[model samples]
Target: MEAPTVTALQTLKALVALQEIDVRIRDLEKDRQQIPARMKEIDKLLEEKHHELSEEKNQLAEVELARRMLESDLKAEKEKIKKWEARLNEIKSNRDYQALSREIEAARKANLGIEDEILRKMQDIEDLKTSVSQKEEDLNESEKSLLEERTELKKKLDSLNADIAKEESTRAESLGQIDRRWLAQYDSIRKRRDGVAVVPVLDEHCQGCYMGIPPQQYNTVLRGEQIVTCPFCHRILYYAKSLEEMSEDKA
Candidate 1:
């Protein structure tokens, strides 16, 4: 609770400032690490879409092949009917001619049925082609949008890298401003306390743990004199106003 030397107050300020930078660095690094996983998810989605499209096209191809085969069978049936018709004039008996005419009639009926089926198959092929076309268009649009999103993530990753580098470039100077004893203590506490070695006292509560501090300790922190730690959390403390003042001075 005693008055703090100007040097001690400055050291406290330096620790607070350094904590801000370290927290930012940790967050940015975490976000940077997640970009690859996100990109992989995007790629997987695209792959699934492509597989669906390929299956549709394959079905369309199969249907078209079936239609062609039907047409070929119809042609063969008509040729057989034509050859049987040509034998009618050469037949001498009535029964023979009647039998040959019945054969031609049956062949014509079969060709008619084949023609109907071919028409239906053609319609199915057309429907499938339309569906595949629509799917391809949708897939292209999705790819464009996802690729844009991926590009934006890349830009964000680059921006975070730059910000981290800028903050780190100044970290050494902040470290130099602190008393070596306090700096050593801050590093030790940060490791043990989840990277939060310095916290602000707000309304007589330790921001780190949200636990109430002793009134005397709160008053000591309010004066911005001497480094204090929360009794419950044992993390170093500073008055919130002191940090604001330091920030304003820099601005």
Candidate 2:
């Protein structure tokens, strides 16, 4: 068997290194993609909570306004009763006195009805206050957690971006070491083969497609004298040193 040439072995090493860089870059980009979706989910939850609190406050405002208006009506009715009482003493005829008395009774009945309505309004106002307090508490708790989560997501996204940038620079340097024709071929193959351009041949099996390699192709790969591509997946085939081969080399 012919010994492997230095140039061929060096090309294989470069290709392997380039593949590692590409894989990591893809993973980091995927992590970066996930950050925004998670942050958006947190924001959506907070928005819903904010709306709930606002609605409760608005309800409280409406209840308070009703209570104030009712109080004003009560004051006006009391004043009317006082004026009617004074006018009763000034009446000279029995018929006039009786008519004034009836008018006063009607006014007092209306006042009683207004007082009952005021009491009901006060009860609603108290219930609304409790609801507003509970909603505010819930919002505060959610905001604290949302703030923490948003911060963490941003940090993760920044880290991923930094890592991806570093890897891209490294990949550019690695491209310079590889033959242009080989690099071009690798890129073309990766585009069609799920970003996997190079794979190991283990025990006559093509790792890319898990297909059995032909005996002639297997021999060429073991010799490492030429570049070989898998016929099935069209991925560049690499010959990995076996445990026995490594042991023998050490000895």
Candidate 3:
């Protein structure tokens, strides 16, 4: 079998290398982008935790204020009871004593009610304190995990960036050796079609779109007369060796 011309072979090699580097770069960039997204997710979770904690603390404060107010009211009621008892000493009739006794009973009931409310508020405050402690613990743990994750991601991004720099240097060297017109054509097609300018023709089919090649076009590709394009996809085409052909070539 006839070998491809030196120019064609070089162009093929360069294109293949360019494709490799491009794929690596694209993959690395995707990974890099994921770092930010992961951090954003962590940030959102932390923000939600903070907001929940803030709301809980606010509720606790309100309950505490209510408890204090209830205590003050209880104290004032006790004071009123003392004054009523002193007035009972000066009661001049059974009617007056009965009226003072009724007033004392009402004050006692009101004080009991205030005490019950204060107890409920204290219970609520205790529950809130527990919740706040748990939330803070969770926040601390998450923050630690986030810091470690950020460090790891940063290391990976740095390594990928180094690889990209090396690959870029190699790609530039390879690109310089390709014919200007062919490079221009490749770039133009790649820009228009998702960075896939050249595609292999395999099994008498265009790999780009899996369209069958007519006998005439297949003959021209075999002849290597000129650069051929797939009619369906308009991508520059080259004949790729089959597995059998590859084995034979290797042998």
Candidate 4:
């Protein structure tokens, strides 16, 4: 016994359906591949925010430490001025007394300059405190927004995975219906031609490559009795009919 013959139109229809499934899978897989990259981007953003916060806190600590050291120095300078004033009361020579008075005046001026610097440091500390507070708030808001975005991306990835699995099952069934010879040729062409193995002949042109078909080949495709390929692009070509014509034919 011999196997029954499969018509060209039947194979073409099967291939068309298979193509639709394959394209859907391709798109779903593409989307699935992007999820990891997007997640990585979110992680990078969070890391940068954390680093900025850490840096600000470190700088604030350093400034506070410097302010404490300045305060200690001021205390030491005040003690020295007190001791020098006590010595002035005990001085007896006029020239020695005059030199001591000028020294006291210079020390007072230096103390005033130190006081001004301490005030600036205090202001700087306050400004840094304000900045740290704002950044903390911003980080909190970013975490909330990114968490929502991550949740949405995970949902999308799960949905895409489910869709891809379902389409693959359908493709398996479609493959079973197609003749092995046709499937092999279709797969080969698809691999060589950017995932488009089958195309419709529309207006005497290959819809896949948009290349014009010769008149004789176009006529042959219209007969729909045998497999035909576009001469220019080597894609399997099917004659496309309007819905009305297809309905009339069915009628």
Candidate 5:
């Protein structure tokens, strides 16, 4: 095969360099997109923690309300027992006295049950208070840690965004090295083939699609006299062995 002219070789080199920038720019943009998603993931965790803290606080309030109600009921029952006992001297008959005694006994039993329940409720309130305190502490720590993480993530997102912008600026500059026709061609193929417009041929195989190129076409591609598009993938093919060295950043 005949050797490529100097100008064609230069064009090929520019194309390679442009492709390099495109690859980097794409990767940086991908990073740009993922950082926000990560932030949202952390935000979700923070929201769940806040919900847990609120639930514990509400539960404590409920337990306290129950304890107060139980106390009020127990006080009412004790007052009734005292008033009924004071009427014992006014009984008219033995039958009436026994009835009054039974009534006092029933009231005392009820008071005892209420007292036990009140004690149990008081203990429950204490346990609930402890739970609320512990939960508040945990929530505060989580908030602090999450805020720190968010700040760090924000920094990362800013850096990735800046890098993406830098790469995009470089891509625009690299476009100046090629003609409008070549740029349009590269853009078209890149859009259709997952941002890959150019590729190398190794062992007569188009690396883009891993399909074998016809021998004659492969030979012409090696000559590099003109831009060659692969038959299967329709991407520009390069032969690194004959032209300039391939970018070490390949892949």
Candidate 6:
């Protein structure tokens, strides 16, 4: 079979517009895929905040329990001190009185320690409660922002989908007008070259690989005499006219 002529190869350039549309569709689909992951990331963040708040609450409860226990101990010590003083009146022996006096002093020291502990625990619980309150507020704000972001992304994704569908329909119609054999060759080359099988000739250079063409190849391309593949990259090549040149040619 004769190698396809350069005029015939030029027809493949029509596919470039189709490729642009397909690229846009792929990009939109990529954006759509990220939407769910982004939402999931927000959900994960919220769950982390909730877990942190729960831990803070538990710490507060523990501190409060400690404070209550200390309070109970202090009250018991005060009651014992009152009982000891009342018994002092009935004590006749000096040794018994001295021993009761010592016991009262020890009870007083124990009461002081318990009161100090209660104070420390109360402070800790207060601090923890404040922290938990702040975290809850932050979590609420973050969730609200995430929800708003999700809504906006959904609207944008829907718009992109609509655009893609319209472009795809147009691309299909354009593809129908192309020759079957040429389309097959285009598809075959595109598959091998990552969706770029056709490239423009600019300034005696192959845009596909930025390689300079020999004089012989350049003349052939200018004449539109025979199809030429880039010697380095093997892509189908064609010339692209500037808008002014195209208009002049039409006149």
lDDT of 5: 0.83
For each candidate in turn, the TM-score is 0.77, 0.85, 0.82, 0.86, 0.86, 0.78
lDDT for residue 62 in candidate 2, whole number 0-100? 92
lDDT of each: 0.88, 0.88, 0.78, 0.88, 0.83, 0.77
- Alpha-carbon RMSD of each model: 4.3, 4.0, 4.5, 3.1, 4.6, 4.1
Cα lDDT of model 1 by residue, 1-251, tens digit: 22244455677788888999899888888988999899889989999999999999999999999999999999889888888888898999999999999888888888999999999999999899899999999999999999999999889989988988988988877776777778888999999998999988889899999999999989888887677988998888988787678779879
Over 4 Å off, model 5: 1-6, 241-251
lDDT tens digits, residue span 1-251, model 5: 23234345556778888988888888888877877888998899999988987887788788788888988888888888888888888877999999989999988888888888878888988888888789878888988988899899899888988888888888888776776677788899999999999898999999999999999999988987777889999898888865654344342
- Clashes by residue pair, model 4: none
lDDT of 6 by residue, 1-251 (tens): 32344344335455556567667777777877887788788778878888998988898888888888888888888988999999999999999999999999988988888888888888898899889899989988987898798788778878877887887898898786556766676678778887787787889999988999998997776665555778888787776553234447658
Better of 2 and 3 by lDDT: 2
lDDT winner, 3 or 4 = 4
| Cα-lDDT of candidate 1 | 0.88
Count clashing residue pairs in model 4.
Answer: 0
Name the lDDT value of residue 240 in candidate 2: 80
Model 4, span 1-251: residue lDDT tens: 22257667777878888998998899899999999899989989999999999999999999899899889999999999999999999999999999999999999899898899899999999999999999999999999999899999999999999999999999998887788877888999999998899998888889989988999989888888777888888888987663234447768
Clashing pairs in 3: none
Model 6 quality (TM-score) = 0.78
Q: Which scores greater on lDDT, model 2 or model 5?
A: 2
Comparing 1 and 5 on TM-score, the stronger one: 5
Clashing pairs in 6: 6-227
Candidate 3 per-residue C-alpha lDDT over 28-49 given as tens digits, one digit per residue, 9 for 90 to 100: 7777777778777877877888
Report the candidate with higher lDDT, 1 versus 6. Answer: 1
